[model samples]
Target: MKKILVVDDEFDLLTTWRLVLQLEGYTVVTAANGVQALSLARADPPDLIVTDWMMPKMDGVALCRALAADDRLMRIPVVLSSAAERTPPIEHPLVEFHRKPLSIDSFVEIVARLIGPA
Candidate 1:
């Protein structure tokens, strides 16, 4: 099964995403903030990452940079989401930006494009 790390501070969205992705046959892992996500990724990297840009501890942009600096994690594609204006662009080649309120089907499609089906 493909592993996915979803990082967001909102608890409800986190739970909903986990259930939906799991149903789609992907092994979903979650983090409340980028700090937690970074630690988790270092310990066990995911096939892809879906992160909210305005997280509390560490934001998605920081996570993307940290990942890019790590040779092992740099190539992982990141889907960065935001409800407000788009954040500053990340320099990493694999980063993609998307506006928030993503429909489940759209979200799944985005994931599949990056890492294929679970």
Candidate 2:
């Protein structure tokens, strides 16, 4: 089973994603902020990460930067979601950006494309 880490500040959204991902057959790990997600990734890296852009302790961009900085973690695929119009520079080949108001079908398609079907 593919393991996916999902990070979001909103509790309801986080729980929803976790349940949805889990039901889709991916093992899901969730965090309320990028800080916790980063720590969890370091300890046990997941195949893919789906994160929200704006967060309390650390944002998705910062998490992506930290992942890029780490040699061991740089290759993991990242799916970043944001509601804002502005985008942060995401230079990594494995990183993907998704605007908020994301559809479940589209999100599933993206995940399947990136790391195989759940």
Candidate 3:
């Protein structure tokens, strides 16, 4: 099973993503903020990460940069989901950016493509 880490400050969004990804048969791990997300990733890296840009502590852009700088975690694919007007520069080749308020099908398709075969 593919492992996914979802990072967002909102509790409801975190729970919703966990449940949605779990239902899709992916092993889901969640973090309420970028700091916790980075900690979890260092402890046990997920195959893919879905993060919100406006998170407290580190925020998604900083988190992405940090992960990209780390050789061990740089290879992991990252998908940024946000409603922000500005998009962060994808420092790593494996990173992808997407807008928020995503439809269920679009989310599933992106997740499936990144993680592969659910």
Candidate 4:
């Protein structure tokens, strides 16, 4: 099973994503902030990461940068979501951005595309 690390500040969204992804047959792990996600990744890297842009500690961009800096975790694909209308200015090769008001169908498609159907 493909493992996905999901990071979000909001408890409801975090639980929603985790449950949704798990039901889709992906092994989903969650973190409330980027710092926790980064630490978890270092200990046990996941196939992909779904993260919210505006987190309390170490935002998504910082998490991406930290991942980029680390050889072991740098190759993991990242799907970054934000409430901002425009895409953020992140240029990492393994990173992609998604605007908020994201639909479940689109979100599933994105994940499947990145790491294949679970």
Q: Pick the candidate with the highest lDDT.
A: 1
Query: Which of the numbered candidates is closest to the native, going by highest TM-score?
Result: 1
Candidate 1's displacement at residue 27, Å, is 0.5
In model 2, residue pairs whose N, Cα or C atoms come closer than 3 Å (at least 3 residues apart or on different chains), thus clashing, are none
TM for candidate 4 is 0.95
Question: Per-residue error at 60 for model 1, in Å?
Answer: 0.6
**lDDT of every model, 2 decimals:** 0.93, 0.91, 0.89, 0.92
lDDT of 2 by residue, 1-118 (tens): 9999999999998988888888899999999999999999999999999999999999999999999998889999999999997677976667888898788888888988999976
Tell me how candidate 4 scores on lDDT.
0.92
Worst 10 residues of 3 by lDDT: 84-93
**Candidate 3 residue-wise lDDT, 16-49, digit = tens:** 8899999999999999888999999999999999
Local lDDT at 6 for model 4: 98
Q: How high is the lDDT of residue 27 in model 3?
A: 94
For model 1 the local lDDT of residue 74 reads: 93
Clashes of 4: 0
Off by over 4 Å in 3: none
lDDT of 4 by residue, 1-118 (tens): 9999999999998998898899899999999999999999999999999999999979998999889889999899999999987665675679999998688889899999999989
Using TM-score as the yardstick, the better of models 1 and 4 is: 1
* Lowest-sum lDDT 10-residue window in model 1: 84-93
Q: What lDDT does model 1 reach?
A: 0.93
Query: TM-score per candidate, in order?
Result: 0.97, 0.96, 0.95, 0.95
Per-residue accuracy of model 1 over 17-111 as CA lDDT, tens digit each = 89999999999999999999999999999999999998898999999999999999999999999997757868678999989899999999999
